[model samples]
Target: MNIPMFTLLVGIPLVSSPVVYLFGRLTTRAQVLTRQGWIVRLLALLAVVATWFPFINLWLEFQARGRRMFFNIESIWLQLDGISFLLAAMVLTLGTLAILFSGRYMAGDFGEEKYYAMLLAMIGLMIGLGCANDLFNLWVWFEAMAVSSYLLVAFYREQPGSLEAGMKYVVQSAVGSALALLGIALVLAQTGTLDMDQIRLMVGTMDLNKAGLLAAGALFFIGFGVKVAMVPLHTWLPDAHSQAPSGISAMLSGVVIEAGLVAMLRALSTLTGFALSWGWLLLAFGALNMLYGNLLALQQSQVKRMLAFSSLSHIGYILMGLGIALVSGQPAGAQGAAFHLFTHMLMKGLAFLAVGAVMYALFHEQGIHRPLVAHDLNGISTRYPWVALSLSIALLALGGLPPLAGFMSKWQIFVAGFQSGNGWLMGFVVFAAVNSVISLAYYAPLVNRMYRRVTATSVKKGSASISWTMQLPLLLMALAVVVIGLFPSLMNWLTEPAGAALMSIFR
Candidate 1:
């Protein structure tokens, strides 16, 4: 309930990143858990755990107060508005799980110390982005995340391709940041306030300068669009996702993009009183992303690249939900978007972790490129059954199959779309459903390669000793996927109230 609790969640990781970099310089360890790596990992993990305590406390506080926002921490960061207590909780939860899953994924890497540090730093930035109620502060954190992410993507600096991907990401992100800053300037020029709550209040009273508002809206959309990888601006995503470390890939696809979306939603909520054109623009972009992403993914041969494109497609669905909420001025679509955001995070995180396991095993033999024929997976279901099973569940959920978290969230989005009675938007939702089936065409091959295909020569099994630190998160996420799928009400309870709070920003 105190600012220290929220600050600790963010500050610990912000401080740990540089510390890990320093450790890397002083230590001669090969594996992350060896030499100074263990201590760094412990501290990073502890920082995550410490952050979780406040989230728990906040949850309790929310229950008692019957208020969605709590722990309002304010200071002179960029503007007067402080962070959202609930969004902070969500960021901490996802960031902790991401780091935990990285344990095994990053094992025996050369730059483990640096890897953990960047990761922790990413966690800190995400918390700041989520918590910041000031648009200027949000933009700062947004750019910070962009820089950290570019570094992480190119962490394998020795690899030319990785460096290239990182450069591409940086260029695109810089353009986006510039646009966002311009939008912020425009908003400030018009409203004389940078605080999101204050902006929302002034938006209605301000003169309706159509040209300026539209330009400002376009600027904000382009900025967030680049991060969200909306169609026509998503060129950097596949390259970055394909080249980045598996753990970084997970975070990128799972949470980082969502942070951008959250910021966009916050900005949109603030500007709702101005016009409905912004909502229309978001809907158009969402439809384009869904169509283009699926079409591109259908052609990808690389596993990671396919996942990257799939991520783009799924983000379309979230945008669709947001668009619907804005167009109808109803909370259902926003709630659906929020729920889907969480479900997508869990499902994609699990999927990437599973892919990491496969890649790790393959690295022992050839590399990620070798075709996984039927015989290659012989007895994999028997030996590493847990990994195999988890991967299967993740893939299925990602395909939007029922009784999984993915399906539950998507169903909510679809219901909201249909309820809006907007014919064009409903058509977009239908197209998204079709894309879901298209996704299955790509995902099914992995399952077929693992279970149904028969190999002549058996491949070697992965080491039986998976670290508890890593396995626990995967197992929990896998279980969560199924649990939320079966019981959608749990997310409904969380997201519905969050959506209500967002809507209140307008009222």
Candidate 2:
């Protein structure tokens, strides 16, 4: 039987998840555990790859038709528009590389079968959340993704830090979900419908309860703010990102938080006049996030923990672009935000995966799995030249250095702010630029340590070869950062439409 594009997009991974577990069960009885794990990993990778077809087809259709498409059943709507397509594509691409990296990274870990299963489930749910057009259904997808991710975060149940981090993540996420649900309930009570389009029309035409709508908007902001790691609501991120497996770390910092941003944007679109009030609120929060994230990262000695904090600062940049877009209705701001979202997934994903490769090498060489301190990377360039190079590129790009994707992405946002001709917004743009320079204080040290000389007192640099599986993803992403940096126009096809889609709400 033929399945709808939306169903197929969500179904491929969800359906493959269980089948992978059953394969694990069968392989256990028929083969050795090592072989069984490889089989499971292979199957999981194929399942993620299978998702590409539907996404590509849908994207082609959108490009050719140049319009949004909807799939409706009663009040439940799953729509394919520029933003949804961009987000879905991000989820699949990053999810695929993370899963592939997992093949070697998670090979001997306990519960290999469950690891792949939960990862796939989270990917599918994130896609659903992006495409969902009904408020209640969006919440359902959000919760489902949270459930799957919580398990993955605590996959190393034997480790105290892992369990502690997972508990923090689940508790904070549950409360955020509750707030979002409450906001949805208020929206439903106000309009008697959860359909976003219907609510938009009702809110625009009807004499609604302004007080009630404002309350819902506030709730939505705080609820989604937790996941976006916006300052003050961002306490849960450092532990969750640092404690989880490196592959999961890439997903959390790279795509997952961005998904939260998209969800918040979609929710806000349903509430008329929210942009006028919330737009400046985003700018204030953006500035706070930048300062908070940068200062905290400077204090971190652990590599992953530092990277986790840097994510907050990058999120702040995206928020600034989005804020400008909302307040001034300039397509440049929205476009910059969209472009940065794409660039960040590459830059950050490469950083984590490259660092994870070093961790993996050390584990195999020294039998240690503890958190890697930044100093531990000293003289690593001599032992692992390729990985050292990859990590340096990632760090430099993330620091917004010239001739890297990060530089171009930040440039776009700065240009957007200046083009608005608002003196205050332009000042924020200067603040963001200075923060970008200050960020290198921490980023540069990590790169410096990698190439520093190994002394008699320094940690041992063992000869542990990084497998092709891990190195492949790192190299590919590093190339992408350079290529995109050189050719910024290459991504306009995706970012332009997304910006247009976002502006549609304002019109």
Best by TM-score: 2
Tell how far residue 384 is off in model 1, in angstroms.
2.3
Our model 2 lands, by Cα RMSD against the true structure, at 1.7
Best by lDDT: 2
TM-score of model 1 vs. true structure: 0.91
Give the alpha carbon lDDT tens digit for every residue of 141-232 in model 2.
88888899899889889999999999999999889889988999999998999988899999999999999999998889999889998999
Q: Clashing residue pairs in candidate 1, if any?
A: 83-131, 375-454, 375-455
Q: What is the C-alpha lDDT of each candidate?
A: 0.75, 0.89
Candidate 2 Cα misplacement greater than 4 A, ranges: 29-34, 72-75, 455-461
Q: Candidate 2 — worst ten consecutive residues by lDDT sum? A: 455-464
- Report the Cα lDDT for residue 286, model 2: 90
Candidate 1 whole-model C-alpha lDDT, 0 to 1: 0.75
